[model samples]
Target: MNGVIAGISYRSLLGRRRIWLLVVLPLVLIGLAVLLRAVGNGSEATTVTLMEKFALGTMLPLLGLIAGTGVIAPEIDDGTIVHLLAKPISRPVIARTKFLVAASMLALFAAVPTFVAAYLLVNLESDIAYGFALGAGVGGVAYAAVFMLLGILTRHAVTIGIAYALIWEGVVGNFVPGARRFSIQQWAQTVADQVSSSPFLSTEITIGFAATALLLVTVGAVLWAGRRLRSFSLTGDE
Candidate 1:
């Protein structure tokens, strides 16, 4: 299992295409931040809001979906995943390794940039920058796990992921209080709520509980996807 994981991780790291996507996506987000900072002579509050609502809110989730899908869908589409399945490695192990890879990619592409962008936009007074970045980082991990599982379980993973991230979570979660309670992004915001000193900026959800629940749900989703992948039957294109 370890050998299979190592092989997959190493291959993913060395792959030019994969590495390029990881590097490019985060850089783009950071670049956008820089561009906004350069152009605007706005107040600090304006900058922070822009970074939070735009960068953290939009870019992070989208990047997670892309990275998660990229990690597994290519292998399945090309039928190279059978090579990993044919080994002594259990399907669960392979699924886990793939999920880890996807999560790592999301962290690199979404989370780190989000933090850096926040820092660039806001002062070091409160932990506002840190909190928003932390929230984005956690959300990135959960999003990656869920979307990676979607990739393994269905060919329509990208479409479904986009709909959930954009429509269900992005739109509904923002408008509906109840939906926010169920949202990964909202849970992440709870983390920011604790770190940031501003009462108005604080999340409605409690930080500690949200963090625990987020971790459990993410792990559960990964495990469920692994079990599902084990019995997944790949039929030839009709």
Candidate 2:
């Protein structure tokens, strides 16, 4: 059931008209990173900051939101999901498959581009490239789960995600110290900070414990979304 649903969702994503827009976002981020390097910043410090702030902070969340919401929202919107539900396949299977496609897409869009961007901008001797990429990858996992559930639970998932990603994480996190702890961006930055040779380029969080918690939340959210999807009533009159 899971395999069939996943296959269908994968094909649906591939057939999307604006799917190429998702591909463009990461490429543009990486291009800007390379351009920043090409311009020859005064120091590597600027490059690292650019990689941390623009690549991880900005690009990852936006890409996650788009990939996450795009996966299921259209089906629900067009009423095609009812056709899938009419089958013997369980709703949980359907949800999980959709999430798998969403999460995989988010990871590819967010993490791989980040690694390429890092390599373009910096030459850290430590495993900074791999570490930040891993952190960003995990961050994408969490975002995909959360936003996918949001897509199921509300009609306003995109708005909520945008508000949370841009207003809460980006704006509030910058101005308020306490808000930083609540941010996906902060958690991801903590992971990146651990890998960078210049720890001063980023701030550290308890990566060992934080990564564990993030993974748990992500998995739990995905499971909860599947359960929610199972119970979702698609009939308009209901």
Candidate 3:
């Protein structure tokens, strides 16, 4: 919400070496879509599989980790966050600003590319493209909030986030019915299912559950991060 904080956060996030990581995933996603299209494998099933498995499952989490952590982690790690904390600005505003930066990064790097790739693979014949795109955008925001809280909570945000994304989301959520209720990916997929009439794109999670969970997680993580920031000590203790 604070423009100055948002500007500094943007520069901090984009100026880092991990910016390449942000660029790579989207490129790989679009490239995969192109390859599948060329091979005539752009069936609804294939499109849904790719979008669900690769785009929402893999790329969204990784991009979220990068953007979410990159916004504030490095500053915290290097002890430069003290400079910002010393400002008269409210701690919540700082947290919210960095969150907005991370969310915007997801919108650009995760959501937009998802739409483009889905469109490339399936076009407008069905709502799959729009469905997946919106799902990804909303999911990316939730991921950003969660991972941002993780960044504030620990220095190993990326490591823990990777494990959560790959193991919990990719493996467990897919196979375990109960676990799917807690998964951001599954909730997002449910959103996609509601939007797209394609039978290939569906989830065990209902739309009501998905909407409620997404809203709760996103808001809860952001508010928690703000509270943590408010009490954060310059010595790196909360």
How many clashes show up per model? 0, 0, 0
RMSD of 3: 0.9
lDDT of 3 by residue, 1-238 (tens): 9999998888887787878999999999999999999999989899999999999999999999999999999889999898889889999889899899999999999989999998998896579999999999999999999999999999998899999999998999989989999999999999989999997877888899999999999999999999999888766666
TM-score of each: 0.86, 0.90, 0.98
Q: Relative to the true structure, how large is the alpha-carbon lDDT of every model?
A: 0.73, 0.76, 0.92
Model 2 regions lying over 4 Å from their true place? 234-238
Candidate 2 to truth, TM: 0.90
Lowest summed lDDT over 10 consecutive residues: which window, candidate 2? 229-238
TM-score of 1: 0.86
lDDT per residue for candidate 1 within 165-198, as digits (tens), equals: 7887779987898888888878877887777775
Winner by lDDT: 3
Off by over 4 Å in 1: 1-21, 39-44, 233-238
**Judged by lDDT relative to the true structure, which candidate is superior, 1 or 3?**
3
lDDT, candidate 3, at 17: 84
- Give model 2's clash tally: 0
Pairs in steric clash, model 2: none
What's the lDDT for residue 222 in model 1? Answer: 86
TM-score of 3: 0.98
Question: Candidate 3 — which residues are off by over 4 angstroms?
Answer: none
Ranking of all candidate structures by their lDDT, best first: 3, 2, 1
